[model samples]
Target: MGSTMFIELHAFSAGSHIRGTHIEASLIGLKRHALTNRYKMQTSINCARNSDKSYHEQHKVANLILPYPIEREEFCLCVFTTKHHISQHPQRGDRRSVLNDSQPDKNHKHRHLYFDEATITVSGGQGGDGEAWQTSKTKTVKNFKYKWGTNSQKFIELPAAEPADGGRGGNVYIRVDRACDSLLHIHKRKFWRAKKGYHGSSAPHSTPGRERPRLALTQEDLYISVPAGTVVRRKRSGELIADLTSHGMAILVAEGGAGGIAARPSQQMYSRRQKKEKEVSDVGLEISPRVTTSGEPGEVVTLQLLMRVVADIGIVGLPNAGKSSILKAITRATPDIASYPFTTLMPNLGVIHCERIVSEKLIDIDHETCALPVIADLPGLIKGAHKGRGLGRAFLRHLRRTRAMLIVVDASGQDPVSDYTTIREELRLYNPEYILRPHILALNKIDFEWAALRVQEIKAEVQSLEESAVGPAPIAVLPVSAVSGSGMDILISELMEAMRLCDEELSIVRGSAMDSRDKSDSI
Candidate 1:
């Protein structure tokens, strides 16, 4: 006996969003329904009677099919941002996490990053075959009205109608439900592909003689649910994916196939009525990340989040520079105050309430936005940061987006002057524009016993460079004790002054450029 059709599961592509709920809009012009009660009853009985069981034993035994399997025809919305390159392998390998191009992380690894419980590839159903039949009956013998006396013959012939294409394969879908949290569904599967078309019948046959059911190709839809503010990113290029701000917004990725040729109608049935079954228009795929209310950052998946635009002043220096300690003293925000480098990954924001003397001037208001700003604790830059050594470019990129830069140098380091130059050079390499931003030098750790002597030497060196160079090396070299909370007020004041000066210079440049343009136009 021929075996029942064995269903195959397709792997949804990475970054494809699968929905947990059904999409009513895409179902238009298609027949989507569960089996009738009686049909379902018979199917359950037959399934239970069968002794041989396979992977889908429970689902088959119950005859509980999904009413609308293709929830949304779209998956993989980020595909447009990705640059495609032809390759022999069907699966894609990510270069950032895995070094080797040949190895792809198991599909289930990034489940936490997606919005839906599953991501799957959908295929269309196969069409049924057609059949042909004929009948021959004659009464003759050149007799009168009573032909019963004459000889009569009758025969029937039937033509073979080829089977219509297998009902196109069922489309794949990714479903997200309230019970799920991560994208654990994709882990179990590899890739998703639609079902192939079935062959046509050998001969013409009507309804009863037809061997298969009439199946219009139906596309499989995939859906996923991720956290709100979850950024969807293109896998290969490491670019920002979708910023899923809304709950139900879906993005389309891939489309399904068109239907094959239809059967011919008979000429003899002049008065017969005919109906046309709509073909499977297309299949769609989309990968969307869900937006969640949780403030906690989501797990790292394909992309990296660099908090640049969010923060203003980034506190950076050598180990033991007291960057974290200073941050605690300035703002109520609690960053671990330890004499160590790499203390903070997330930036801390603080409000610097202006003192009586500072708040009196109009310029002070302008300084507030630029000077007293949200500070970020960036990983310290070592000698080789420009070349991407020791969290090099990553740290620098974070600083690049800041309006101003702050160098928290160690007062007791062997060479504070050299440290400042090293940092400036690295910044220049990362972005030449960084040099244009107003920056200051803060000699921290002044409470250390040896810091007095070191602070003097460093201040002299910086002052001497200021005299020799056309412009100042930095506005001033202020000594600060992060432990004792000393010199913070003065440092804040200096930052305000520098911001005011920078703003004035910017205004002057804009005015001069505009004036020059007017002069040219007049001439």
Candidate 2:
């Protein structure tokens, strides 16, 4: 419900003694001054009036309930009520706020906001203006009074304005929020502006001659929250500014302007009785007292935000290749799966714990949560994917930060080897760096007799091709049926091992690069 108003007053105040008779004023302004501000609206109020004096025959106080609209009469009495869905303060939640309550699922209502790229404008707040004092030779104060004999008192005039300095403006920053899994929250918003600074003010008990020392209140800074792995870039120049990869990482996007100062008066005195060297020159810099500095403008920037999902392993395959099914079987991800292509438009992420080999068997380690393999089920790719066919470019970028790839192929397809080659070629054309990452082959749909018959042939061909490859070779080839869960245990172990090796290689590369940079800096 919208805001409702409340009003309570006496009808005697509405019209004071008209023809020496009191008339009830229904929603009209009170004639008598409200000493306690009781006339102020609580929420909002609606009043109905009966101008005729016939309704004023009863001179008794009554409690009025609104909404019936049955002609309310008397001194104005107003009250308001609101629904729970309506927030009292939108900027912050109150005790009655339902924002913290469990939300109802409206299937894919905000799916459009899950885009990978977005353009936005961000700005920082302007700084406050500095304070100043009036010029005077001596302290301006009231003189004491003598009470005895002929009592006399002297009073000094005080300025009308308050003596205080303006507060500083807030700065804008980009912070990574772990709860934000996507750019959905900020994608729809086109412009972001921080609050401006306060105007100039003076200190308390300050006079034209002297200013009291005091601490100024600082302003709060503004922070725009985005998901981890969001890359902030300048829209016009395409310059990379910040890359927030991990949670709790943040960067300053714009700096607030510095506050300005007001003109303070200074005295100039010269004496001829002093020596020539002691004589002071009257020529000096001077600022006019009428000058009052205003706040500086905030920084405004148009930015392009690109988000790449950071996962340990990425699943790549053609449309209708059972990638989602394989991911579902491995972890607890319930992705949209169908025989048709492009079923999984947005990427889906699932986590699987790392295991250690004990007694020649896989054992889950409870404390290995830090480096658990996070599997990403990306949207399927098609022919000419690198040429922007089937939204492949957007899907391919999700693999940029992954440690390894899990390529799933439909074993029932006419040519499993050709499909595997097509996927590899697409990755190579999109980015050669992707080929350098470890890759695993999972021949899906092996439960069918016809597909199972050709699984060994496909596996052998893929291994032979991998042996001929340069750096990015297929780590292992395994035939598994997502529907029947055949060979899933061994397939999972191989994928885990491949992910571990890939992570170690990446860490070594990063460490070597850091060492080289250090050496250069020392030189």
Candidate 3:
């Protein structure tokens, strides 16, 4: 054999086998080395040429037998092409599979950091004490001088002095913040208190009963930032405080205390009411801390904060039911997905954009006019989920704020009808009103021939309501393949329509509430 150069290829081939002296040219790419590195595997020989096909054509995957002692230019071209492809798509386990190939975490990273409910104690600041004269001092007033001679001047006496009034305390308020998505920050600390008010000082030269100093100042109110859609309520009584839904919306939870009244002079007797003065004891009532009025205590209350994830459409399904896949196919959110149950432990949010088609391309999808809907993919539910089984309470709580529901049933599962029934029952058990909400049924994993064939049967079975059915039927049932991206358009359109109807219903309810409020005000 003539003198030839050999390129020892390593274990770079993925899934495909290399037998005898022939090796498949397909490689998983150079791992942990440069371009000219040798593959630490068995040697390969023999080469097959396909000069007719392009590099990226979907013709056929043949054994890449490298012909040794070949020209340097051709050899460099093949290796470089393989390297470029590997770099561009480093996450692809299989070329035709889903875009992300990384395995999901055993315990999802987001599930641990999530915080939904918190119990907090908030109090307004205490009012500052009214100040009184600390020590007694002798004051000399000019005595009236009359006609001793014509040059004598008349004198005046000073009015009695009063103690200074105190400043008001700070208030506690809860405000909505768009940037904050979790209550974890507030959950860390259970108590929130406002700054105390500044004390007042007496003015000696002022008029009687009006000797408050000008330096006394009240504290600024304290504002706690919470994510939109947070519902505050009295912890003990369960009375609703406020539903902070919009950005910049705020409400006062606790009010500050009133300032203490200053002590009066010995000549003027102290009175409880402002109407008239009652002559009290005048013995040793000079102006001591005991004689003077003290500050009033502020209001204290314990509040329960519940965080509801606000969204337009909610995705519900059984575990490994392709809910995450549907979300990824429609929106840009990349959730951790595996072929196992409980893969998605936390909710994922995404925005659904609507665009118009013009001349075979996307056009004028103005955000202001054609507003997008924010969708959430919630965790899967099992039987008895409403009773706190498998994070059921959290999943149900998060769904309360969604405008519409998208029930995704795995068509490839043992029983798609049973899965849908379980999810619906769980929702109804948690909140009966949830059954009345608009729903869109989605039969996912229809790419398989068997699943596709059973789609109509599953839809028919779900249509015949159970004996305990309490609400309207689903708007529509669609067969979709989240992995292959088929039938997603119709499913999305149905969901958008359902969301629109829900929004209209909400607007009608709001309008009626406003009208009733106006009538009461007029009356």
User: Clashes in each model (backbone N, CA, C under 3 Å)?
Assistant: 74, 17, 3
Q: How do these models rank on lDDT, best leading?
A: 3, 2, 1
Candidates 1 and 2 compared: the better one by TM-score is: 2
Q: What is candidate 3's CA lDDT for residue 192? A: 77
Local accuracy of candidate 3 as per-residue lDDT tens digits, 1-523:
1222223333333332221111133333222222443422434443343343542133232334332322223232222222111111223222221111231211122434347777788888887767665532334467666566677655645543445556778999999888888676674345677877666563234543543333347679999999988999999999998998888999999887766655544333243323222222344233333355556777999999988888888999888899999999888889999998888877888876444222223433444655677899988888889998887787788998887888998998899988888888888989998888888988999999999999888888888876476367889989999999898777767776786687689889999999999999999
- Each prediction's TM-score versus the true structure: 0.44, 0.66, 0.63
Per-residue CA lDDT of model 1 for 240-342, tens digit only, reads 6454433454433222333332332332211111111112123332211111011111122222221232355666666556677776766666766655665
Question: How big is the positional error of residue 42 in model 1, measured in Å on the Cα after superposition?
Answer: 36
Winning model by lDDT:
3
Question: What count of clashes does model 3 give?
Answer: 3
RMSD of 3: 21.8
**Stretches of candidate 3 exceeding 4 Å from the true structure:** 1-114, 134-164, 201-215, 262-291, 354-370, 464-471, 506-523
Instruction: Assess each prediction's global lDDT (C-alpha) against the native.
Output: 0.45, 0.65, 0.67
Q: What TM-score does candidate 1 get on C-alpha atoms?
A: 0.44
